[model samples]
Target: MGDDAPAALVEIVRRWADDPSLLVQRAAVAAICEPRLLKAEGAAAVAVDLCGRCTLHLVGLPLAERAGSDARTLRQALGYAWSVAVAADPGPGLGAFRDLDTSDPDVGWIVKENLRKKRLARLL
Candidate 1:
């Protein structure tokens, strides 16, 4: 069971690394599984991690199955949403996100600008 989860996750990540479309990225979310023997043993369930820090739990739907679904479309939409969130969120490790309006689809485009303005590489 434990082995299955890592294998599946690796497969998905490999697929994503090739082309790197939002569809494959979202579908590659990791799932953890455990054994359960009903009442006495209790029930074990599988969970997928969307982002390591965020922990967006994906409902069942495996990567293979999602390939046929509207996954690509959903993934694009989610990527856009993530960018928007990243832009608006004013938290640590996200100092690169401030000063952006959600209207722009390329919200992450500002990262380079931030780096340039701060003269980070120039310091080196």
Candidate 2:
């Protein structure tokens, strides 16, 4: 019973990682599983790619936040995931996330923060 929830949650994140129809569900589960899944086999790349591919303008962010996760956790997880994806393959990996719009205030803020990190890295 105790192990079942975590396993089930991970399974959900894996199963729906790239399912556009289920982006909200996938994001929710992924946000919750971000810490563990990032260390799981190939999970970080998959989640990062899915995050870029899915249209997460409305439901994804709110649902993820409401899923008992904090902003810092999500940001760290996403940044790590994106960094890993880019390191693995720059074109497809980085290109996937390039078109993300900075419209939603929260998403915009995150995108700006990520851009700032990248800019700072260039100077270093």
Candidate 3:
């Protein structure tokens, strides 16, 4: 499962990929799992793609609250998603956050936190 699990799990995430209503939960699950899959053969692309999509979903939201999880999960999931994206390649897909100044404080805080994690990832 470790070798092929990310792709399999990504197929599950793709099922809800187009539904804005379900994006948060789907992304939360992906965020929780994808990072571990990053080193898996052929898993990086799928995990990065999922994280990119999830990051876009978070950016497009007016507030992280719009992701609809109880508050804490929403914050943590977005952070994890961002970390996966940055750790993947730090490209525009996720690195784009470096250029924005969102009006929402929650969004701002989470982005900053994710960037911090990204830096930590690089350090380790």
The lDDT leader among the candidates is 3
Candidate 2 residue-wise lDDT, 1-80, digit = tens = 11336556555665565454443543543453344444545544654555564335233656555345444444444543
Q: lDDT tens string, model 3, 8-114?
A: 76566655544665445555345434556666654555555554455455556765466466445545676666566556545543545554455666567667777
lDDT of 1 by residue, 1-124 (tens): 3343545544444454233344444443322112121111111111111222111221224647445545545434333333332322223214323333434333233333334433223322
Model 2: residue 77 alpha-carbon error in angstroms: 2.3
Candidate 3 backbone collisions, by pair: none
Predictions: Cα RMSD each: 14.5, 7.2, 4.0
Query: Can you tell me which runs of candidate 2 are displaced by over 4 Å?
Result: 1-13, 16-47, 53-72, 117-124
RMSD of 3: 4.0
In terms of lDDT, the poorest run of 10 residues in model 3 is 23-32
